[model samples]
Structures are given as C-alpha cells and as structure tokens.
Target: MNPPADADSPARQIDARIAALGDWRGETLARMRALVHEAGPEVIETVKWGGVPVWEHAGILCTGETYKAVVKLTFARGAALDDPTGLFNASLEGNTRRAIDIREGETPDADAFKALVRAAAALNASKRKPARR
Candidate 1:
C-alpha cells in the first residue's frame, strides 16, 4: 500500500491541484483557501474524497469544490450558523450544509465570507469531543 501522506503533503497537493486547474476556477479556489486561513489560523488543510480541499478546525469548516462554471464553498455545519450577510445561495434545501456558489466574473464578499469561516470554526470547536483521560 502507498505510504500515508505527510502532514504537509495535503497543502502541497492542494497547491498542485490549483496549479493544474490553471484558470478562474483555480484562482477562485486559491482565494477562498487564503480567506479560510486568514479567518482561522489554526485551521487544518486536507485532501479528501478524491481531491477536494477541506479545511477543518476541531472539525470540518468547509470544502472547496471547482466546476466548469462555478467554484463552490460548502460549509460543514452551515445551517446552524447565522449568515446576516446572506452569503449562502446554494444548498439551502439541506438541513446541515449550506454553500456559496461563485460563478465566473462574480466576486464574493470577502469580509462576510471571512466572518462565515470564523463562525464555522467556532461552531466546530464548540462541538468537539472531550479528551479522554
């Protein structure tokens, strides 16, 4: 079996993925990734589900998915978070998740998005399991 990926490998892989995309999708995902990090400096990055870039702090904060026409940021527990800025425009029908879909030539509100990221990180920390003795 292949050796497990090192702790830093995920970040490298994500960089490669963004580079491979080489388009607006790559640029969008990169920008969102930077925003997530800025919002939660303690956030962890990992590659899961065959190449999705996931960010977590205590638990999953969100996943960045790219498509031909849109780059989507889906929060893990978005339905529970308050979105006063109304950034969520997709996956509204879901009970536990909400998503912001950014289309080509469209720009997301950076301040609001960062606030959402911080909130998501806090929510994940709140739900963390206690350490066992």
Candidate 2:
C-alpha cells in the first residue's frame, strides 16, 4: 500500500487532488500551477476559499482551480484593467470577475499570464484598504 500524501507539499496536494479528479481538467490545473510558480518565484501559495490555492503578494490577486475539462484562471480585479490582448473572459456580467479557460494540449499564453499577474500585483499594492481594528 502507498503512503498517504503530505498536505505540506503543494505539488503533492495538487497531485492527490488531481488523481481524485482523474481527468484532463486535473492535468490542466497542474500545468497552470507550474506556470504560476514559474512566473513569480516570490509568489506564495495559500489555501484560501474551498481549499483552493490562491497566489498573491499584497492582497487577493488570483486563484486557479480545476473545472470540467479545463483549468480556470481567475483574476480578482480583472475588469478594472485593460485587456487589449483579449486574454480574459467575463466570468460574470458587470462584475470584476474574469477568467481564462484552458484545456489540455493547449499551452496557456505565458506572456499574457505574466502580464496579468504583474498588473494584479500592482493593483493590490496600490489599493489602500481599511486599517484593521
């Protein structure tokens, strides 16, 4: 029998989750994780809402999750930014929600993703939230 996976290892956790999923979606998610880490070595992986791995620096920047046959990359403040490359899709109408859905064998545009990440970091850094009481 194989030993249980470690929760501390993000890759392992993701792998286990992917194994459970058993689909192309899982593979796409794993690839997306690699891309995020590659884009920013300073990027920290935190388990936020629903045990999803959220990558951020100053504030909630982005979250990646597996969907049916695709990996969804969500940018929190995507609507506020200018997307001339047409890389983002409106996840919701009239809201800040935006996502890019990529499938297996489809190499995500690394440059575009990096650009979005940088933009997100800048936006998060520039914002002034209410001071904690």
Judged by TM-score, which candidate is best? 1
Per-residue lDDT tens digits for candidate 2, residues 63-111, read: 8787666678888888877676887864846578688877777876778
lDDT of 1 by residue, 18-87 (tens): 9999999999999999898888888888889999999999988999999899999999899999999999
TM-scores vs. true structure, each candidate:
0.93, 0.76
lDDT measured at residue 38 in model 2 versus the true structure, 0 to 100: 70
Best by lDDT: 1
Clashes per model (N, Cα, C within 3 A): 0, 0
What C-alpha root-mean-square deviation, in Å, does candidate 2 show against the real structure? 4.5
